[model samples]
Target: MPTFNQAYWEERYKNDQAQWDTGTVTPPIKEYIDQLSDKTKRILVPGAGNGHEFEYLVTQDFKNAVMLDIAKEPLANVAKRLPELDAARLIHADFFEHNATYDLIIEQTFFCALSPELRDAYMTKAHSLLAPGGKIAGLLFDFPLTEQGPPFGGSREEYIALFGNLFKITMLHRAYNSIKPRAERELFFIFEKK
Candidate 1:
């Protein structure tokens, strides 16, 4: 099994092997952000590599938002682009160990990048980090669970099974607005804490 540790991810960035990074916020997430009426919601984009979505939130005036990542390189990259951003908003911490509450957690490439073994843990941590009735919204990779990945794939059944207990599945369907490369493979979902 690939060791999905901090060092492992740090090296992926150093080696420029982070192909999952689209270098900009993708359409599905942008649409989700566009629909959000509450600008002051405390939002988190954990494992937010390069943090383009976080950057987008900043541009849209989402002041109460933060992006956390285990790798400093990506966070540093985000900082370079948004130089005026508050330094504290770019958090360098492990997601599971990080302490805070948020009204919304944006999921993009983050979940698939985690080891399959950590799926349940990710779900539990997300539940804990959210405020009451808080939401976790974004895309999840929709494919067969296979060994060949840091970009591990999972089926719809798997997601329903894993998140069902702690979250109310408000939306869990294949994304209609994915970019060319991601079009049939991403599920845009919104899960509200139970």
Candidate 2:
């Protein structure tokens, strides 16, 4: 198992080992964003490597969007790509230690990239970061949990068990519009903070 710390991710970006980057906003997430009527909602995209979703959010006029990552490289890439984005919103910080609250947090590859031991911590942190009635939404890789990953795999049952206590599982189902490579392997979810 890898340490999966900031240095590990920084090295991955420096070496161009970010195989998880899709170079475009994911369809399921894009559709979800499209349905959102509040363009002013405070949004956070943690572990936002390359920030394609952040780009989409900005393009859609979500001015309060914040993009965070433990590694500086990806944030720098996003800054370069979207030069108009406010530099302050491109936060380079450890997600676990991040303290601000948000109305919505967009999850992409962030959850799977953490060590499985941090799953509970991730949920707790996410819960803490959301205001009451706020939501944490986006895709979760739906596969069996195993020891072989930075891109760790997990199942729907595990997710419900893991997050159900602190959040209302508003939507947790197989995503019908995932990018082809992720096809049937993802679940689009909306977990409202309880």
Candidate 3:
């Protein structure tokens, strides 16, 4: 199993080879963010490469948003675009080692980028990072699992099985508003920490 480690991901960024980067936040996530009334919610976007969603939160007036990644290039790119956002809010660290809590964690391609062995750890960490009643909302890919991918895939059943122990599955279904390429192949979900 190819562990999606910092070095591996960093090299991909260095080569500008992030095929997963949509260059903009996906439509489904935008819609989800649109419903959020509280701008003070402490939101965390881990593995936030290039930070499209991170910038979106800030532009939407989410004052407590944080963007964290293990690579420097994407973080630097984000800094260049959103110069006014606080440097403290942009973190360059491993998600597993990050020591803070959030009211919400926005997932994009982050979860699917990891090896299967780390899925449970990712669930555990997400549960730990979220405060009581906090939630995680975002897209997860829906396809077969294979060895050759950073953008790996899994089914809704597998995800429900993996996360139901810790989260209340508020929403898990096909994403109707994804970008053209991702439309039918993704699932939009909101899992509230119990």
**Candidates' C-alpha lDDT:** 0.95, 0.95, 0.93
> Each prediction's TM-score against the native?
0.98, 0.98, 0.98
lDDT at 187, model 1: 97
- lDDT for 115 (candidate 1): 84
Model 2 deviation from the true structure expressed as Cα RMSD, one decimal place = 0.7
Model 2 pairs in collision: none
Q: Write the per-residue lDDT of candidate 2 for residues 1-194, one digit (tens) a residue.
A: 77788899999999999998999999999999999999989999999999999999999999899999999999999999988778999999999999998999999999998999999999999999998899999999998888988789999999999999999999999999998899999999999999
Give me the overall lDDT of model 2.
Answer: 0.95
Off by over 4 Å in 1: none
CA RMSD of all predictions: 0.7, 0.7, 0.9
**How many backbone clashes can be found in candidate 1?**
0
List candidate 2 stretches off by more than 4 Å. none
